[model samples]
Target: KPNEIVVVPGKVLGIGKLDHPVTVIALDFSSSALRKIKEAGGQVMSFNKALETFKDFKGKSVRLMKQ
Candidate 1:
């Protein structure tokens, strides 16, 4: 879905493409991943920033990725 918030426990790499925009929160992100995300109109943020920014979101709009 577009404008969704996703949290990655580890680093995010650019291995694929995004068809919709999203807010990616991760411990780290590859340069290519950052570029690709932005190119797709998505937003990226560090875990700490996400904590402060989305403190009120809880489980309503945040997704935790595992794999």
Candidate 2:
């Protein structure tokens, strides 16, 4: 799970729960959304960080565009 990364834009709601290192980048965030990211021990990186990290990928199918 070395390359595992999560991306959330806008807001992250309670669809349920997740136990992973998800990096959230949004124009804004809700308190609930922020809590979930921290609780999961994930990082709340800025959009810039997201883009930079994505570029360091090794054949990732997912597309991450700069903001």
Candidate 3:
């Protein structure tokens, strides 16, 4: 979705393409990946930033990956 937030528990690499614009929170990301994401009009940030931004996770459109 356009404004949804997705949390990834690992690093994001530049091996694929993103077709939609969404917010991605990950531990780390490669330079290429960052460029691609930004090119697609998506937002990227670290987990720490996410936590700081959204202290209350409830009632928000956030997606968490299963372990």
Candidate 4:
């Protein structure tokens, strides 16, 4: 699911088109962020790869975590 690619780095460029949305988990935060993640049709997951991170997205769709 390339379209379901999750770009761990927060470096997004407008150089191409991705029919599939990518979830960008960043180490930084920005204002008016809902527009960025929501507009991309992707979610902004924070530290989900960590042990206690699952608690953040418990009610949402999450699976297949890799270390």
Top TM-score prediction, candidate number: 1
Residue 30 alpha-carbon offset, candidate 4, angstroms = 0.6
The reply for model 1, stretches above 4 Å from the true place, is none
Compared with the true structure, what per-residue lDDT tens digits does model 4 show for residues 1-67? Answer: 4324343445333343434455555544454454555666766655555335544554544334232
What's the candidate order when arranged by decreasing lDDT? 1, 3, 2, 4
Q: lDDT scores for all predictions?
A: 0.89, 0.60, 0.85, 0.48
* Model 4: how far residue 41 lies from native, Å: 0.4
lDDT of 3: 0.85
Full candidate order by TM-score, most accurate first:
1, 3, 2, 4
True-structure RMSD, every candidate: 1.4, 4.5, 1.8, 6.6
- Rate residue 9 of model 4 by lDDT: 44
Please provide, for model 3 over 1-45, each residue's C-alpha lDDT reduced to its tens digit, 9 standing for 90 to 100: 777888889988878878878888998889998998888889899
Better of 3 and 4 by lDDT: 3
**Clash totals in order:** 0, 0, 0, 0
Ten-residue region with minimum lDDT total, candidate 2: 58-67
Candidate 2 lDDT over residue span 1-67, tens digit each: 3224545555555456757756565556666767876788766766787677666656653334243
Q: Which ten residues in a row have the lowest lDDT in candidate 4?
A: 2-11
Give a tens-digit lDDT track for model 1, residues 1-67: 7888988999999999898889999999999999999999999999889878877785657789995
